[model samples]
Target: MAAIATDTHPYGRVSRLFHWGMAALFAWQFVTVGARVLLPDGALDDFLWPTHKPLGALLMLLVVLRLVWALVDRTRRPPSLNLAAHLGHLALYALMVAVPLVALMRQYGSGRAFSPFGIPLMSGFEGEIEWMTAIGGIFHGLLGWVLLALVVGHVGMAILHRRLSDENVLARMAPHAGQSR
Candidate 1:
């Protein structure tokens, strides 16, 4: 059998790079969140918590890029293995976009300045918008936790697919050369 081209096989290099890169970032984000929740007021929480918003903002950008790339490469990229996988991916994308956006909304509504990576995204104002802040305060963290759960389920399903199915789904996303489908 011939080896599938990167664009036509599992995922292109760019796709994999986005996937793994965002995975690492999400891991860091979770660590920061966990520390904030479990070790509040401690040095670890203080250290990691500060990165949460900035990192979330970064993830939001990356996810948008990834979505665009996926669309551009859709014809060449590997097909979804099943309906479940397709729906799961859609949910992931939805949550990924929503989590950061709501947080940003809250930040803006709070009338607080936010500069992620030293770029001024929001300027502080005198009065807070109660509804925007309330919506974000309610959903941001809750949706974030939901996203994390979905991620865990995603990984679990991938493992199950690899172990039980005839096809090795992992090969599509795994870092390897000359993969075939």
Candidate 2:
């Protein structure tokens, strides 16, 4: 086995920046969505929901950029755990890109008002796809759970690699200097 220490298989600076920034946005989304569903109306919550739609749009764009990066620089995955693990990772990436899209589609199809940075979208198609939006809402919920499960497994594997095995799993993702390991 190789030592995937804090310095091993260094992700490019763009990759690292996008990786962490996207992660923070994703966490924010989970909180935003959860609050929208679970909390009653309030000034704070009302203000927060608007952020969700735009942030989701930003997430979709970032997904495209991340895909391009992944293709151009096929990351040196810290040695495969197994075929299942690889497949699981593939699935997780697929859904992260897919779920938000369905939600965006729902916004368009349901005639719901949304703005990506206050620029309205889908106005031309309002009242055009009510049924599609209805279906999208259901699909969005399903995708959310799927994303959650995949994240749980990923986090668990990272913990196992660090605490049980001798691997430096978490460190591999921490901030690093240029080259001195």
lDDT of each: 0.87, 0.74
Candidate 1, 2: how far from true, in Å?
17
**Model 1 misplaced stretches (Cα beyond 4 Å):** 1-8, 175-181
Candidate 1 lDDT at 135 equals 99
Clash count for candidate 2 is 0
Q: Pick the candidate with the highest lDDT.
A: 1
Clashes of 1: 0
- Model 1, 1-181: lDDT tens per residue? 3433322367778999999999999999999999989999999998899899999999989999999999998897888878989899999999999999999999999999999999998889999999999999999999999999999999998766656655566777883533434
Write candidate 2's Cα lDDT for 7-39 as tens digits: 465566777778779889988888787778888
Clashing residue pairs in candidate 2, if any? none
TM-score to true structure, per model: 0.92, 0.82
TM-score of 2: 0.82
